[model samples]
Target chain A: MGKGHPTAARAFVDNRERAHWHDTALWFVREKRDRQAGSLPEWELLRETASSIKRHAQSQLADYLLQFEHEATANGAVVHWANTTSELNEIVTELLQSVDATDVVKSKSMLTEECHLNEHLAEEGIDVVDTDLGERIVQMRNERPSHIVLPAIHTKKEEVGELFHEQLGTEKGATDPQYLTEAARQHLREKFLNADAAITGVNFAIAETGGIVVCTNEGNADIGVSLPKMHIACMGLEKLIPKLSDLSVFTRLLARSATGQSITTYTSHFHKPRRGGELHIVILNNGRTELRAEPEIRDALHCIRCGACMNTCPVYRRSGGHSYNTTVPGPIGSVLNPSMDPKEHNSLPFACSLCGSCSDVCPVQIPLHHQLLTIRHSVKEAGGLAGSKRLSMRLASMVFKRPWLYKLTAGLGKCAVRLTPRFIKYSRLNVWGKGRELPPTPRGSFRKWYDKNGGSGGR
Target chain B: MTRMEVAVVGRTTSRDLILNKIRAVELPDVSHPLVDGVLTGAIEYADTVGTFVGSAESVGARVHFCDTDSVVDIWHDICEEFGSGKTANVGIRGLNDDDLTDDSPHSASELVVYGTSGILGVAENAAIWVSDRAINHRVSLCLTQHLVLQIDAKSIVNNMHDAYAKLQDVRDDYGVFISGPSKTADIEQSLVIGAHGARTLDIIVVEG
Candidate 1:
């Protein structure tokens, strides 16, 4: 079983200051996304277009993948298929070993993280370096990325300064972000120059011309791909688009919804292999086909992994990304994780407040809250629902079914609450009363007071 | 090769297994985005160059707008200000593209600057479209310490919709929409320039 959400969240919220800092940082990004969305006259139209395009592509996934494979092969790319994440890791490791590549540099590819590719490669005795600054920081600390885009969002500069001192040998207490970033630049450039191979994640794979797009603000993907003789691109099956022209719609919305930039600094398109080099594209299914069969949550597959939902989600911001304990964390992760293992990740669906902010902020318009609620029902069907929640829900349904019983119980409950000792009412069993309190006892029940006050519309 | 040994199995069994699994699942056929009557909202701007400059500067790139007569002088001043290091001037009017093909320029030069034309500018986002046709060596665009690019003032478009409509002219084996120099906000959301590519990018918008 996975570490439960409530258990993990308690650890993060124990330090009130850090929790508030994390909340404020994510909120800042959310506000920036709002400004970008509001500036465009056709923002809603763009979202609808992108969503439909993804839906169409997904329904015809088999044909599109075939078309993309044919086109990419014609463009001189070697395409590999993997039914499982470990299969993907095997393919990547075999490719690396064939090239005699020991020192590998990889850009931020969450697919690899999901499959534990780094660990697998290390066991094979190949050294891999994460070129993205945020990813490098988290890798140095031996931790998973908390946020997809902002991998180091959970870390503070002062903490980074301490990390750099230990890892990159920076001056002690050098908390200046500029100085620290420069030191990282010097450190990573050496790795880039010496890397024997590079790996990247595909943001969009076009089927028309057989091209793959990788977007980054730091240009690490381009540098890594350009310098190495053997390069590998890892992609989920959901990354394909039918044609080249579809890029304009997705590219316009991706950055504005992400970090609120009009566009990323570098949106590089790699159609062919480098001069006298090799290009390998690994397409992974890894239980996504099962998710496609799920009618209520299949819309989650349209996600572009922009992390906007994570930025806007109140529960995600306060509880932190580590609380989810998944490769991709936050609103989308909560929806996708339970599909992987219902019994192990059943806590994820219950970790939401049913707030629709994530859906509203989602550029692809995934019905996240509705999906979470639907998944709650599915979890109950699978017998993975928590015991207390099932019990309370059962009692609530029984009480709500009969009006006479509810009224009689409410009158008696008011009397009992007023007469009981304070210790019993606020006992540990009352989880609702932990941070909140019951309202003061009324003089009489609402039904009795309303029935006697007046029968007319106005009193 | 060992890669081909593993490739044979990966291409056949795994491919058919995945495609078969996906095909068995029935899903509703949805309309393509373009066919669904959703327009791109053609945003027209009166002053494309002005809009391009503002957008580029907002993203931390410096844009120098000039005419054909005095454009080279601006590049000279820019090169002088940045440094007198190993600059790779590619297809510039007053400079030569000789340094661009230096043997291992990335390791040899302290600074490799590429002053190339064939850049298609977008007004909405300051995205300058470039491809292999512009410069023979695409890696220099990233390995350079300082980058100098040229774009025709008349070639600037209003938005990405218009830009993509006209991308056929420069689309090649590789293409990029470079708005600014490489930057990162990974460490505590702090904006740092020159993450792994060119530290400074100056786009010279030339008008006839």
Candidate 2:
């Protein structure tokens, strides 16, 4: 099982030792929040406006898709549609085969990961190298990214040094970030210069201009896509925007929220292919349309793929990225993964603490917690609820329906809090205690204290 | 001749043929008139490129605001970040006449800071586009442990047209538009920001 594989929960448990790295990562993001927000005193207004723009765009996604196909085709960029992962894989493999590409360099495209493109490509005897530093690390380890922005954050510099030593042959014990970074640059540069074709993930596809925007901190995306004669851009259909003008607000919010930078190092804009460069835009449905059809959850399509909401989320910080067990994990992923295949991804919705920090930090202002609750409700409605969970929830609901019973149950809960041992005997109960401490119960309940202190009416 | 690259799937039915027989489909009405002069105004002032600052009051950051081909002043401002470290550069607008020497420290104040001409934003994606020109060492934007960018208020535009129209004629080179930080939630569906890029961003907006 892979590091993030479902069967690899034991490995995940071991990696929880690095929870401090996770905490530091999130704290760093939290610190950047005010600077990013301060850049636009109209930050909230801009978020509302962006949400509306994404909503309006999603409402007309079908039209935009058709328009994009028309414009892209007219501009000499081929457009292909894939309703499933297999279809997407086939299309890409065929394109590669058609071009006789042996070694393909790819910039950071989460779509390729979603479709498992590399494994399929590898099976076909095509070697694909991820040019992003974090992607490269995960590629070397054959592990899925632990975090979207910092895929290799779970990896210490020492570990990276070891990986590079084994893979790239840097002397025995060089763990310097700068030295390691230079080694990566030197190594990836060779791949960038010689690759037959480059594949990139599109950050935004401006439908009005029929252009694809690729953002990266390293210049890898530009080198990969521009140098190659055949360039392919893989994007979720949800990546489309109605006009080019809309990129401004997102540019302002995306970097600030994702990494607290004014901007990513490189934002390459490609409209059709350049001279002697062939461009292709692949629009993969792969469950996006299904998500789009659902009114309550359709706004998920508006995600600019900035990882801000995830960074601010407490549960995500503690559990780390591998625990989510999906191509895209975290708050947005919890709501998004289900839409891809609800039955298999049902566990994702339960992965939240419902603190609503995600909604607060979301650049697009997605009501992430509400969407999560909706998914949880839907999962329960689908009869997928576990027996113990259902029983507990049912008992809890029953007490709430009757005041006397509620007070009696609340008293029982308070007593249990005091009586339950630090080491819970139940294996299932102990799972909840793994990441967090159980709150201590006072001699009396908060309600009782509030009542004695005088209620809101007294104030 | 090479075989046609089109894929052959199921046979086309008469119904499909009839559907395809339609010569043209009705197109949606797109009546908004393109404003010629409206785009030009921003393009003219677009030359009003500026550098970024930290906390708006830093001395070097201030000199970056009023840059005018004086290499000595630029070098001095850059040196202030380090307090008392030698710096090596091809040239600075305000500080040095001599070429950069080996005595220069790699950084000032623990980190070296540089300015970009301006920042670009993709309104559609909520991303801020900064060019390599603003960054030091080209990879400084992401490579440095800390990076600070100063952005002007008016450079902001609405969408891709604004981005293209402003820099459409820019010299062929590298540019980037960052949206927040580099991030991913690829783990157990837990969203964590600051995955691979800078962990923090400090933006100074100089108000006129």
Candidate 3:
């Protein structure tokens, strides 16, 4: 079993310097998002319209998928469907094998990460190199990407330089990002030119135009897909939109909310195969339909994987994405992971401070905090709550239910806490006291202080 | 078979099961909103061409504002600075598919400059539209060392909404909106100008 969020976060925040900068860096991105979102006077309307569009799409998803498949097939492209992650992986492997592809290049794809596609492909003896710089760094280190958008957000530049020195043979201690990126560019360029196939993630799949849009800032997807003879695009089944014109709304909000840019560097649309090349899109369900059945939290499906929620999440910014221990970490992950496995990720919903910043910045206007709250109840009802948390809640309920018990404990609990030794008070049993010190016992209960000042109790 | 028996034995292909699950999902049936090209807070560009140049320059593209007559001179000067080597021209007359080997998008030349190549210019974001229909070799837009786009000033639109509106009739099998030269801030959030695509994007906005 994996450690809970608090335990992992303790290790993350242990390095005070890194934690501080991590917080500052994410906050900087959050501020940038604000500036971009603020630039649009119709931002709220856009969010509402996007939310409406997503809901409409969710309602008629099956029809849109059928429409998309029909149009795509007519456009001379092949469409594959997968009900599970393993099935998706097998389909991609078979496609690559059909072409006798030995070397493959892929751009940033959270779905592939969720399915561990690279690991699966590697077992098949097919080498798939991640082309995104951050993704490549984490790939080299044999680690899961902490954040969906910024895969190497947790790694320092010096560490990247060291990795490059060992792998690509750069200057021993050079820490400049510019110098390091240039090296990766030169290296990945060779990989792109030599790669037999290219795989990318679909940003938005238009049903009307039979096109799948792949947005990128580095232009990696375009170069790789264009150079290779075979291009396979993988996407979650929820990425479909009703019309081609619906793209403008998302494209407007996506880049602004993601990296504060007006738009990505490349928004390449693939409607058909390149000349004689093969275009195959693998649409993976992977429990998306199950997630859709959850009416209370169904709004969570509107996520475009922008990472804006992560950038604005106080807990995520401080504790880091690694603490979430999920493929797509932060607010959306907390809500989505519990739906997949309640027992494993029950602690995730409680990780948030309930600041509602995620909901505020969400381009699609998903009520994230509300969904997290609902998921928390669902987790407890599913018998996924930790015994320690259950015990604390039971004790609190016991005291609050009875006036005598509440008054008695209120008076004695402070003295007990004050008199107790630090070690005893902060024992392993006190899960609440793990990373934080209980605030100095409030001078006195507010009830007692109010009575002393001017109270009916005196009468 | 009875309905219950049929339902019990209905677990078939994954696609069927997946689509059935989606069909069972109960969500509020919302409608797609009608979108017009004119949107709120749309930037009013006093001069669309001038704004295009500024937006393009800000995003790391070298911009040249010239008339159709000066286009030749501008192309010549930029080409001289950008290696003065083999180039794959798309729409303009210089060197095209006839001159180069139409074999692969990855030309053997170290310096491949593509010119007279853009379909339109988007002023709001500086994204120029180009497609497989015109470019023939789409990879050269990114894989090449440099990209030189020659866009008519009248074709520049104010924002993405307008850009898409103009593209209603111009849909190709594969098209791209090249906003700027390749860039990435993925490595520790430090912005790098060139990643996998062209290092430089020079635009020749041919106006009156």
Candidate 4:
């Protein structure tokens, strides 16, 4: 088996400066989230309430979804459901074709990324321009988003400047963010005006009013949907909530957790299409239904995609998002991806240090670290590890079970470490010794020391 | 056969399959958490208008306070600040003032759109609620160079929970809680004022 995360992370960390920059940058966001969450006196209570609401919604998803469809259809929207990613892509392509749309502008939707909708549409000769500034940057450079909320976190300003200089024809060597943003604004402005259809991802879909909320700092979702005659919104089935009031709970926590902002600049709630316009809502259940059946991983469905877990993950911070090699990355992705395809993504669960920072920062209070631990057991049960590794684990477990054997091995290990030469200790067999040193071995076992200091209950 | 016709064929069957899968989920029922008392105590401002102005300014928005009757004069002042001449593309809607009567809602590249906000403003976040009825076109709020909103100072609330309570029943096709101008920190974590929306947002609070 290929070494998955460690090998990929080594590639990312090869450039020490860039790796350090990425770590510090994400830590800054994590700090900002801490400040925002700290400022709220009822932040913990809010998280509890949000988690409960999501649990209740998921348990009764069928009822809520049907109610939403009824209300939305009554509100003059056409709601479609897809059982797979290809089905969702086909639905979106059909919607665009029905409108005879050639040019489509899309806001940043991780659901679309998951479905690979842009590539699917491109095959049929449809041009979908991503409108979010960061998405647009990465789209032009032909790279996937490294960070979910901040799609281009892996990209440096000079690299962005070079990309814009080539794609948008801005002045060469113009690395100022304000200057680059203005060029994107001018270029995307034209695309927005002439686009025939707009596609967006739903942040929250309210069951009571049949409305979908799309939050953005750049207002790209609002601009794309408002200008076009047809608005197509795609959402995972988990985005549904029972009532409109639950939105207040999520809306308050989402932007604060994502970017340390009190609120996004625009939180647009689209109840229906504009007068004389078409609104198509596509709900996709690609492997999420099976995920909900797994009781151990069902809580992960509560994710609102705020991306706080990613920013707070130490391994993710150093390794970067691309190293996970999944549509969603970080601690949550590690758990969710393996559950979907264990053999293919078995190494993802091993990517964590089990620090539990992701669980603490999660807005919905998903026990992410515990979920990763569970997935690790499942991976082992499936025999996803290499033969040598499995044998090593079995030997270790055998030694751990027998006290005398363990004691003998521990004593021998101490002697072996003390007598080993530096070259042997730091050899290729010892992966941990590459950037670290072996600590000096203790002369005696802790049990022996405890016996000598005080017998049984003397202390 | 056209692509549209082919797509229309499988819509019903796909819907059935998805709903069936959802119905098959047999997990135990989970009750929604009781949030009745969780949001009761919020940070209150002694001076709501003052707090609103400070909060709005902190989020990169310019705030102006004027008496209800001086809204027109304040609009003129804002226009002057934005360097508006007689031939400027200033579009105003939903503000029932004869002096502020520009009716066309066409959003241009460099147009300035003026409108009134729906009831309710959160003091903690300086967010103003605007529904579809408050403006002719929602695109005008986003597709303009600058957005000038006229809000009533008396409608400010303490926090998001209270704001939701006030707007829970009103049914509009579209609405938004705009906190400030459009912004992005996507490039090297640098904050840029305008990414693809209104570059500047001017809030004219009308004192009751």
For model 3 the interface RMSD, in Å, equals: 2.0
Instruction: For candidate 2, write residues B55-138 as lDDT tens digits.
Output: 222211132343244434544554575455333332233222222222221222123333333454343333456654433333
Give each model a TM-score. Answer: 0.95, 0.74, 0.93, 0.94
Tens-digit lDDT track of model 3 for A366-428: 999999989888878887788988888899999999989999998899999889999899988
lDDT of 2: 0.64
Candidate with top lDDT is 1
Off by over 4 Å in 2: A1-17, A416-438, A446-459, B1-208
lDDT score, candidate 3: 0.85
Best by DockQ: 1
DockQ of each: 0.68, 0.11, 0.59, 0.67
CA lDDT of every candidate: 0.86, 0.64, 0.85, 0.86
- Tens digits of lDDT, candidate 4, B65-141: 78867777777677677676321222232234312223322343446544455467888788888887745556767
Q: Which regions in candidate 1 have their CA more than 4 angstroms from the true location?
A: A412-422, A437-459, B1-7, B35-38, B102-109, B168-170
TM-score for the second chain in candidate 4? 0.81
Q: After superposition, how far is residue A188 of candidate 1 from its true place, in Å?
A: 0.4
Best by TM-score: 1
Ranking by lDDT: 1, 4, 3, 2
In model 3 chain A, which range of ten residues has the least summed lDDT? A450-459
